[model samples]
Target: MALHFTDVEAALDHLLARLPAGLRVAAPLGLGKPHRLLNALYARVEADPSRPLHLYTALSLDPPSPGKGLQARFLGPFLARHFGEDFPRLAYVQAMKRDALPAHIEVEEFYLQSGALLDSAQTQRRYASLNYTHVAAALAARQVHLITQKVAREPGGDRLSFSCNTDLTADTVDAHLARGLPRPLLVAEIDPQLPWLGGSAVAPDGFFDVVIDPPGPHPSLFGLPRQPVGDADYAIGLYASTLVRDGGTLQIGIGALADALCHALVLRHTDNARYRQVLAALDPDLESHPAVRDSGGLGPFEVGLYGCSEMINEGFKRLVETGVIRRKVVDDAALMRRLADGTANLGDHARLERDGEYLHGAFYLGSPDFYAWLRDLPEVQCRAIGMRRIGEVNQLYGGDEGLERLQRRDARFFNSCMMATALGAAVSDALEDGRVVSGVGGQYNFVAMAHALPDARSVLMLRSTREAHGRSESNVRWNYGHATIPRHLRDLYVDEYGIADLRHASDEDCVVAMAGIADARWQAGLLDAAKAARKLRGDFAAPPRWQHNTPQRLGQSLAPFRRDGTLPDYPLGSDFTAVEQRLVRALAWLQASTATTSGKLRIAWQALTATPGRDDEALRRMDLHAGAGAGTWFQARLLGLALARTARDH
Candidate 1:
């Protein structure tokens, strides 16, 4: 009578009997392998050829071309087979980071309506402005049965045909029972997160009459490329830090710039420890947590931080484990006690208070191990926040609050733009004819919010230069036709070279200020171009010392710190394999020095001789490929060819 493996089939059958006939079920696009219940449904669909229940999915295949990414890998072949050839059934995934929306959604109606004069209510009613909204509507119209790996506690009513609450632990089961599920349910008594710790509880442990302890599928994995912080990043970090009141809340996105902003805070504490200390003492629990003492030499200003991001990654956990985010001054002990009991929401448990504001992050990405730790934490005051709320709060409380409210205030916002011109336009990605590479997600919202906040500031991080023709060139001077945030809105721009404050500045001042932070190698060229175009009113010359402020120099300066473990620049929970790590380091070295001096050439030759792996081959081949025409690479390759010929002659 006990729920066991045999009970699973029976339990599923019973649930199926209760469901309305001909109901179709769809799972989250990326949710791993089909459960036995889903497998059973597929078998039923195949056996009953007449009433084939169609499963509408958000999954899609990568484009046939090389540039197109992978598709249908997350879901099992069962769903893929049905949707692969079937029109209208689709799967959705992130095609690009600049826009939160999928690439396929046609925004023509939204764009066309922007031109028309319509009331706000009418506009809201008519426009499906974002891709996700379309996804929701699609599912709703199909009347499709949807299942999710992690369902938001309440996703409205009667939409789901079947839900498998698959947690088997005692506590998890108890939690599930309390929720009082009225829908058709197929419960699996087997533990879903068994290999992990005890704190990770599941929902509704005893409600399932059938238990299936079958091996769980592998979780989806993602990769993140390591990028260096540049001049523009430094500027943004500094300005954004200014927005961070001594003990305010923070919600940061991931990337090199995010890392840079954190590093700048470390640097700020180092530069002025006393000021930071005074700030920290104001917090309720000033001297308790280890993060204040252990994390990267943070001083008295060891500002307690809580995360509020959608994607919780290793960086956030590391901050907690290492103690940068553990210092909490609980305002409501009863609420904390509720979280400890695991009865409250998961979001609240993750919220950490510092100074006065609660710190919570809604965005993050990490390995299963990292998430397991988060899974155990009590939901104190944390909540899963969305873009709509993000836009709303930022617009409401940004800078209007007093300094006390501001410092304990969550006023700073850090974001990135793809291209920012001297003329005040920003673009997240390149635009092509009649098509947008990226859609406006929350940039406009955040910018507007920053402007609305009394103490808030919008800091834009960018690099001074980019690599081209086997050499680095100033990105500031590159000709761009796209714009996302315009020049007039530009506040603080940071690169590895330096920071530039551009708000309300003349175009010339903006260009000069921006040029000052350009890689020293390209500073003169930028200045000369500005002069030629009459963009600069005064000095046409830049000092040689300033000209050397390239990414290469910044990396060189930062390298020793990394080697000694003084600076933790490595990506948290690395996606870099061993071979990739070597390639990354070698590539960084190669980019750092352009010297074709005899000593440098000797070193390069030795490296090629000693390690003739794919990495070396790729490096050599890249040089040859880039040198195919008349450019710097061509000159370097030609010289090498000449030197080889002379050696043969000798």
Candidate 2:
């Protein structure tokens, strides 16, 4: 029987009394972290400098800090509304940000919340570079003293569920046991809001040494507001969608691009004529591309798809609701093989029901709506989604390689990258200067697995261009210093332009394919570099079709669909209201405009000439009023111009 407590301080006292002085604690990443308990522990350690503390984790969830000026004013109310006003933030994270950690205290992570700790030198220095599947082993190696996470249970139920995270807890505990190490103290904080899940997510009896079921009024789960998808995102998504084979497997990362891809997949299944129209508008000859012709299709999914991903984001949920993610995979290898070969009897519904699952994911973090959907799912429907361990979801050698291979047939592992080289290296996780943007979680595993599997391909998606210092720079380059996925493992690369099939292609062919997908402005320079390096033919000229790969052209192609609701900005539902959505666009425009000196001057000029004409609602939402101050007036005018510009462009 686990010791139960109603107060976090009592649990802290118990931990302090039992654990050693040099406390090494492990917490689950993302939504699974027990913030209240962790906060209390951190407070205790901070107050007592004699006790050294070491915290190991990844993707520590921190609510967005409302910064100064217009951005802060706009976000403050929204943050409080979305994440409760009393939401518990990790004290160690704040201490690290302020560079005020005690001399003996340290915080290390496998993955930093995407660029959150970029400027925090302490965090960057203590960062651990490990794959998602390797985190458990790393924890065991560190000989962590405690493993604590928030868990779920039904009202007055004895059983516990790992809920949003089944990523590493069991694996870490098992790894420790296998290594003949002492069993780490297991602690669980019961949060009523967490959805009760089954499969590998259910914990065995007496799994925890301590359980803290605090009194009511629990804080809301941190919800990631849906990002607005741009024209480039839709173009990239449409191209990527064509590469999905019917009845294939999908593994997508999270973000606007992933959402766009899911939206495109839904459209492909529901309104395929519009899908083809948008594809044609993007590239008239897209269907004839070898990657599409050989490995992809531009048709509705008759057999649907099975999802196997590390992060079960909101996109997967939408895909499921749209009937695009209905292909069920059973755990039995023999059954899977028989089903694949049409040898198994279709009439045996009982066995199928016992073993079938439409999706297998390690963890989930998404909007509140997604959580509710999972919480309210019928038992039968809930069983269709299996929350497994990261090792099982990310790799092939875990439990049953044969079963995994059968289940992941025609797999397309889709992930986003920051940049890629013309020769086919991907820069996904870090910068050239050895600064980690986000640690390599599972991109490499999925990419390598794609190669190990006979009929699978890893699709690395990136926008063709990004705005840096208010100027468009090509993401496809001739060379880059760092690579998360090197050229040797190069596979499918997708941009707004098209997909580059570099699987087994030679240097020259890879150059051509990569250049075909580069922005039109940068294509010539990339090819010139390739030619100078003697990697490409000097006589080869850029294709005429590739020259039209520009944002203007992409916007023109997708504008009609965006108007007709075929391609929505928030394809998944949004927490942001209509006015807030408009403000988000305007604020994005303002940020981009202020990125360069010339752009800043232009914005200043616009502010001087512009008037805050009939946008009272947007102004009131931001709390900007007439005659507040010069700074306020200038901000109002600048925002007015931005709103007008975005509106006109749309």
Candidate 3:
């Protein structure tokens, strides 16, 4: 039987007693990192300066900054003012932001919940750029002497289940045990709120050395709500969604881009005519890429996709509910074949046997609403989503190759990258000079999986440019030193402009292809750099058709659809009311305008002209009845922001 503790300090004291100095503690990435245990461990390590605590994990969430300057300033106050007490202020956020973390506490991140802000420098220096599949191997080499994870009890028994994160823990233990390594210290923090999922859920009494059942619910800080998908993100999503085959397996990353893709896909499945309308707007030559033209069509799913996503978010849930994400794949070969042949029936679970799970996820953290939905699900219903070790889900080449093949047939591991070299290499986390913004999560694993599965393809989405400090910086560059996915593994790359089909393309062609998709403003600089470096001839020019890849063109194309409300910032749907939706539209337009000098001037001029009482469309765009409840606050703020911008411009 495991020793039970009333408090974190005492529990960790017992845990520390079993371990040596210079401890390497491993845990599941994301929400699975037991915050209480970590706080206690941090305090314990703080007291002892000689022993350095090496911590390894991935996708660690930090306190989200609303954004830069005016956006963060105005939006932060607005959210707090509107939501009031309902707004979340997570304490774990400070762990990444502040300097309370001791120097001896070495944090090694495998991934980051990226949103332009990278808080810690010490953690960045200790970053490990390993594929998700190799995370276990790396841990084992260090003789990972300790493991602590969050788990849920079986209502009454000592048997526990690793609820949110089965990703790294089980596989690490299994690998260690198979190699005859001494069992690491296992500590399980029992939280009642964690949903008990099946498939490798059960753990015997002997598995854990200590169990700490906390008094309160594990604090689930709502994940950064989906970012607003503006014209750029929508355009990217529109093109990227075209690459998704109806019958294929889908893997997506988090944030606005994923949400945008989900919206586009839902449109494709439920309303193809509307989907085609928006996609055609993105590229007049929608048939340019044969794959997007043929395999990717505007139609409902005849063969619904199976999801082997490493991380499941609100988008996945929505997809599931809409029946857009229904095809199930387990380890069984026959079931995989059935799924491929459009004969697989999930209702017949007995006949449609599973070797592992239908959907293998590591850890999940979404909005509070998303979590509430997850918590309310029945055990049988939850069976469809099986949380597995990160090692297994991240890498498909290991262990059962045949089984993985069947489970991940037609796999499209769609992920985001910070930048990509014109020659087709990708940069996900860090910059070229070595400032780590985020750690390389499962991007390499998915890229590898895409390669391992002959039918699969890695669809990496690189937004053309991200506004940083009010300047648009291109995500496509001449070359980047730090590569998340090397040029060799290059597959399909997409940006707001269009798709770059670089697979099997020559270096010169890769340059042309990448340039074609990059933001038009930045493409010249990229090409100039390439020419200076002798990679391209001085006379070389972007393909004639590619010259149409301009933001102005994209905006013009999307103009008509904006009025019909087809290309919305939140395409799937919005929980916000009509009034709130208008506010969202206006606020987003205001924030986005900061990216361009001309845009700022135009918005400033418009704000200057609009008087408060009159029914200005700009005012109406924010809200119709501007003096009611939250709308009252929005009206004041909107006017104040306009005034502020006008004065600032002067």
Candidate 4:
């Protein structure tokens, strides 16, 4: 039987007494962290320098703390409302931010929350670059002997569930046991709010060594707010959606682009005529593209799709609710093969219901509404979403390759990247100067799996341009120093303009295809570089048809749908109120305008001469009043101008 305690400090005292010095601990990433117990342990180690502690984890959750400024005035109240005042933050992350960590302690993570730790030199130095599947083995190699996680159980039940995270804990324990080493100490912190899931997420009562059952009113689970989608995102999503065949498998990551893709898929299923109309406006010849002809279509999904992704966010929930992700896959290989070949009869319906799952994921993190949906699911609906191990979800070489291949037929792995070279290399995780923007999570595994599978393709989405210092820079470069996915594994690439099918294509052909999707201003320069390198003919020039790849063209094509309410900014719902949503747009505009000297001067001049009172509601939301101070007066005026600009553009 597990040793259960109700007080976190008492549990910490017991752990310190039982474990050895120089303790090495591993915890689950994202929402599965046992915050109370970990915070207690961290406090103990921080107070006594003689006791050393090392923590290994990824994606530490922290509530938004917008510093003192106009931004803070706007976001302070909203953060309190969304994340709750009692949301548990990782103590180590706060210490690292202030450079207050003790010399004897160390914190290492395989992945950082995207762009969260970019300026923390201490964190960047200790960052571990490992794929999601390889994290367990890496932790085992480091002799991680203690595992702590948050778990869920019935009101008075004995069984435990890993809840939102079944990604690495099981694999870590198994890796140590397989090496003939002693099993690591397992600790669980019970949280009533976590949903109890079955399948591989269940654990027996005796599986844990210590269980902390805190009193009522537990801390809130971390929730990621939904991002607004833009014209470029919708255009990219529209092109990517055309490449999904009916009854195919889908894999997507999180962010605005992924949400946009989900919206496009839902549109394709529900209002296919309007979907096609929008697609035609974006790209008239998209249907004739070879990639679309060979592996994609432009019709409603009669058989629906099966989702197999590493992370299940709100997009997947929306897809499931809309019946766009209803293709069920069973665990038995023979049954799956029979069903695929139409040899199985309706008599097997009972067996299918017992073993079928429409979606398989390793972990999940999304908004609070998504959590409630999971918590309130009916038993049968809950069973259909099987949470498995990271190894099974990310790779094909797991123990049951044959069954996985059958389940993942016609797979289209869609992911996002920051930049791509003209010769087909992707820069997703890091900058050229070796600064880690984000660690490589699972992009490489899916790309490799797409190559191993016979009928699968990996599609990498990129925005054609990004704003840097108030000027537009092409994301498709002629050459780059860093690469996450190299040219040898080059596959399909998509942007707002179109798709570039580079699988098995020549270097020259790859350059031309990449140029076709690049911003029109940079296409000629890209081709010129290829010609100078002797990779293309001296007479080569970009086709006249590609010259219209501009943001104006994309916005014009999608503006009508946006006006008619067919396409929306927050299709998946937002936590921000109506006034706050307007503020978000205006703040984004202000940030972009302040990125350069000339733009800053222009904005300052406009603010000095701007008329006020038109944005009183927005000003009141941000708590900005007249004559508070010179800074406040200037901020109020600048914000009013930004609001006016965004409103006019809308």
TM-score of each: 0.54, 0.98, 0.84, 0.98
* Per-model lDDT: 0.42, 0.91, 0.72, 0.90
How far out, in Å, is residue 470 in model 3?
Answer: 3.6
Give me the displacement of residue 601 in model 2, in angstroms: 2.1
When sorted by lDDT, best at the front, the candidate numbers are 2, 4, 3, 1
Model 1 regions lying over 4 Å from their true place: 1-149, 152-243, 263-311, 321-357, 378-410, 432-439, 528-535, 538-545, 569-580, 587-650
Superior by TM-score: candidate 1 or candidate 2: 2
lDDT of 4 by residue, 90-128 (tens): 899998777678888899988888888888888888889
RMSD of 3: 5.3
Off by over 4 Å in 3: 50-52, 65-100, 115-119, 154-159, 334-350, 353-358, 378-380, 524-545, 572-650
Return the candidate ranking by TM-score, descending. Answer: 2, 4, 3, 1
- Candidate 1: residue 443 Cα off by (Å): 2.8
Better model by lDDT, 1 or 3? 3
How many clashes (backbone atoms < 3 Å, residues ≥3 apart in a chain or on different chains) does model 2 have?
Answer: 0
> For candidate 3, lDDT tens digit of each residue in 140-191?
8778888988887776565788877777787788778877898788888887
Q: On residues 1-650, what C-alpha lDDT tens digit does candidate 2 reach at each position?
A: 99999999998999899999999999999999999998898888887878999999999989888898889978999999999888988888898888888888999999988988888889988999998999999999999999999999865678899988999999999999989999999999999999999877888889999999999889999899889999999888999999999999999999989999999999999999989999988888889988899888999999999999999999999999999998898888888888888888865445776668989999999999999999998888899999999999999996999999999999999999999999999999999998999989999999999999988999999998888767888899999989999999999999888899999899999999999889899999999999999999889999798878888888888889998888888999899998999889899989988998988898899789766465788888988855477899887888788888777434
Worst 10 residues of 4 by lDDT: 346-355
TM-score of 2: 0.98
Q: What is candidate 2's local distance difference test score?
A: 0.91
